[model samples]
Target chain A: MTQRDHQQKKMQIRDGFIAGSPIVMGYLPIALAYGVLAQQSGMSLMELTGMSLLVFAGAAQFMGANMIAFSASAIEIIVATFVLNFRHFVMSLSFVNQLKRIALPWKFSLTLGLTDETFSVSSIYRKQANQAYGQYFYGTLILVAYLSWVFGSLLGGLLGDVIPPQLSQSMGVALYAMFIGLLIPSVKKQHKIILISVTAMIVNYLLQPMIGEGWGIVAGTLVGGVAGIFVLDEEENT
Target chain B: MIWMIIIGMAVVTLIPRIIPAFIVDFVDFPNWVNKWLEAIPYAALGALIFPGIITVVPEQPLIGIVAGIVAIMCAWFRLHIMVVVLSAIATVFVLTL
Candidate 1:
């Protein structure tokens, strides 16, 4: 590659790392909690970290650990995981659609790192910055976030007993805090989002008793998306 | 047996995430479909935050709520995400103490 091309690539990687740093901070506490919970559930350090490495999903892994603790069958846990992660289908579709010009290979590998945090950060970064960042940027962002998760899980699994219980419990709020931070900008841009988001939250809340949290999220997002189609203006930029 | 369950969970999770990338290349979504897709993040964020936030501190749900409100306030000012998160954590720590 030319000198300018190489320099630009370096910049993209640096920018991506910067963009991903907050997600790293957010994931550490949550992943640590996951490790502690998984370890408590009788998962070996290898098994817990293996799940983080392979699965790379926060909510599903937590649920999987919980089910294991309860002695839920393999079939039940797998099915529950599929149902919980079904939201990723929409997220991956949106991500692919956004970076349509990028190569298929990049899209394939990048989607593997697509979690709730990464997807929200990327989408908001795209809309707010109005820049179609390079695949290198996304690649680096995903890499850092993924590493932090795995490392945090390893630490939490090993030190599950060392950390104070109350402190770890308080750390549970970190992810939700990050979510709120991501959501506020969009809500400010479009008042319609407030309605859509509230609708989703209420729907999830009401349905959690019957359909469960996993399905509740899926149903909530679908209903809220449909609400968006009507509530959001056609001329409005998403 | 545990390994089997873990592997099974991995496969099921990977399928949903990876399949959509390949499919998006073949299909061209209509405009309305695109709009719906655009809204997914916000909706999903909403669902992910609620109920989960309230239940974060299982023993004292109020601590979670107070921390959540602190997060919303920090975010409203457009503070950095880390600041928002840290502030919320601090709120929880203080409340629990």
Candidate 2:
């Protein structure tokens, strides 16, 4: 509100924007893959764009589109997506604390950009910054991600099955690589992360062939995360 | 139906992020919950990443897995983003040739 406060806010936005640039390296290819997948799924340009506008999360959107291509019922598609994406809720809990003092409407916009990549990037920036422009910094990052995803989907939609199947399939590697990059920074902290990683792999592998593909994500998250806590508690107490 | 999808996306996305706000109001969690919480992202990212790595590749199933390794290593080294990307792309490129 004050002149000094406003200036500081502007500076935070600028640095957040600069720091956030690397995230685009991750977003662009993933978005491009989303685009390619959407096309392969037979989504019309409008439907793909509509998804980009509404759903926005790349993996969930891909899942939803793939389900639609298979003639999945609307309920099935929506539920599957919700299950796949529920981890964002966990990401947001701590995320919202900083904006606890900001107004409701701005918080709403910040939530839009709270996709996994955005959450990781912005949260790191927020820790370095004072509260002055937490909202602004997040806003810029989300805006860039949102635009990249939508546009990439649009390009994929337009390209439409032209991409070779091998290339199409290989695109899945981009996001997996991003995940590994994210993990390197925190991998050393505790046995808990190591245990959790092992648990997630086991749960996913065990559950996928038995329970189902889409369902494993929801199950793996809860089972793996909870299992890690129990194991940690026992180890720490003993 | 469209509105439902839009609203569904909005609510689902909103709920996960907001759970801790009202969540603590009703339920109490133990201290270990903090350690569990720290690994949540890795848990989530692993779910996504595992499928990419383990899914069998076609022409050379080995190439497919190798591509995943190369890309992640390139990315890990903080190699130029374009190079990291091209590493995977080139892996597929050579194999396809």
Candidate 3:
């Protein structure tokens, strides 16, 4: 690569790190909670960290840990995880389409790091970025977030007892708060987002008791996406 | 047994995430399909927050609700995401104390 291209690449990676900092902040406490919970549930430190390394998903890992604590069967845990993570299908599709210029190999590796937080950050960033950002931006973004999650889980597993229960428990609000932060900006720019988001929230709330939280999220998102089709203007998409 | 479940969960989870990258190259989507995919993130973000937020502090659901509202207010003011999150965490910590 030329000197200018290399410099640009470095800048992209740095920007990615900057973009990833908030995710690092958001993922740490939750990952820590997962680590503590998993350890308490009889998972060895290796097993819990291994789950973080391999799965790299927050909600599903927590759910998996809970099912394990209850001695739920392997098949049951797997099915529950699939149900919980089904939202990723749409996310991956949108993410891949968003970065269609990036190579297939990069897309595959990037998708491995895709989570609710990273997807939201990247989707929003792509729209607002004035210049063309490349895969290195996303690669760095995902890497930092991934490392924080794994490291935070390890730390929480080792120091779970050291931290006070109330403090650790309070960290649960961090992820939701981050979501609100992500949603509010877009809602300000485009009023349609309010309707889509509120509709999804209401549907998930109503359906949660019946079909369960996993299915509730899936159904709510689908309903909300359809709501967008009718409500969102074609011009706003650009 | 734990290993079995961990591996199983990993496989099932990865399938949904990785499959799209491979297949999306082959099939072209319609305009509406693209629209639906574009809308997924907003909708998913909403679904993730609600119910999950209220239930974050199961014993005191009000803590989560109050924290969530604090987050919304902070975010509305265009504060940094880190600030928004920490404010909510601090709110919860104070409320629980």
Candidate 4:
């Protein structure tokens, strides 16, 4: 590559890292908990880390660990996780406009790392910038978030048993905090967001006892999303 | 047997994330689809956070709620995400002390 192109690439990568820092921070404690939980549930270090490496979704990983703890069959675990991660299809399709200029191979590889945290952070960045999402920018964000997850799992696998009970348990709140942070600015910008989100939360809560784990979220997402479309914001309309 | 579970989880998770992006490149989504897509993040994050947040710390559910309120405040003020996260963690730590 030419000198200027190389310099641009470096800058984009740096931006990606900066954009991803909060997500990395957020992922660290949760992934650590996941690792610890997996280890306590009888997974080896390799199995724990391998799951982190290959199946990077936080919610699904937790579900898998819980099911494994109960000795759920492999097919049952897989099917449950697939249903849990079905929201990724919505996330991916939402990102299509920003991802248009990216090459096919890079786009495909980058999608592999499309966790909830990365999607929210990168979407905010893409909205603010005049340009399309650069390959290096997207790739670096994914790489850093992915590594933090893997390493956090590894640490948990190694140290899960040793950590004080209270401290590790406190880390459970971090992921929810991060998700709250991600949603606040948007909700502020568009008042309609508050309605959609609150409705979804209520629906999820109401459905949880009846429908069980993952499906509640699915039902909530569909109801809230459909409800949101009809409640158009005045700002976007003009 | 463990290997089977790991591979199975990997394939199922990857398919939802990867397949849609590939298809979207080829086909155009209708306007209603676009509108629903826009709301996906808000709806998904909402569904994921609530009720679950209350239960995150089963022993002291109040601490989780307090931390979540702290997070909402920080984000509302447009503080850095790291700051929001750190402060929430600190809230939980302090309450438990």
Candidate 1: residue A81 Cα off by (Å): 1.4
Q: What are the per-residue Cα lDDT tens digits for candidate 1 across A141-231?
A: 8899999999999999998866587887778788899889999978887777888888889999999899988888888888888788878
Would you estimate the TM-scores of all the predictions? 0.94, 0.75, 0.95, 0.91
For model 4 the local lDDT of residue A229 reads 84
lDDT of 2: 0.64
Q: What is the lDDT of residue A90 in candidate 1?
A: 76
Q: Which digits, one per residue and each the tens of the lDDT, describe model 3 over residues B2-93?
A: 98888888888888888889987888888888788778778889999998998777988888999999999999999998999999999999
Find the candidate with the highest lDDT and give its number.
3
Native contact recovery (fnat) for each candidate is: 0.76, 0.37, 0.80, 0.74
Candidate 2 lDDT over A60-102, as tens digits, reads 8878778767877778777777777776776665455444555
DockQ of 1: 0.78
Candidate 1 wrong stretches, greater than 4 Å: A127-133, A235-238
* Tens-digit per-residue lDDT, A7-71, candidate 3: 98898999899989989988888888899999999999999999999998898999999999999
Top TM-score model: 3
Error of 2 at A140 (Å): 2.2
| Model 4: per-residue Cα lDDT at residue B18 | 85
Question: Model 4 off-target regions past 4 Å?
Answer: A1-3, A128-133, A232-238
lDDT of 1 by residue, B1-94 (tens): 8888889988888888889889889998888988888788788888888888988878778888899889989988889888998999889888
The local lDDT score (0 to 100) that residue A164 gets in candidate 3 is: 82
What CAPRI-style quality would you assign to candidate 2?
acceptable
Looking at chain B only, the TM-scores across the models are: 0.95, 0.58, 0.94, 0.88
CAPRI-style class, candidate 4:
medium
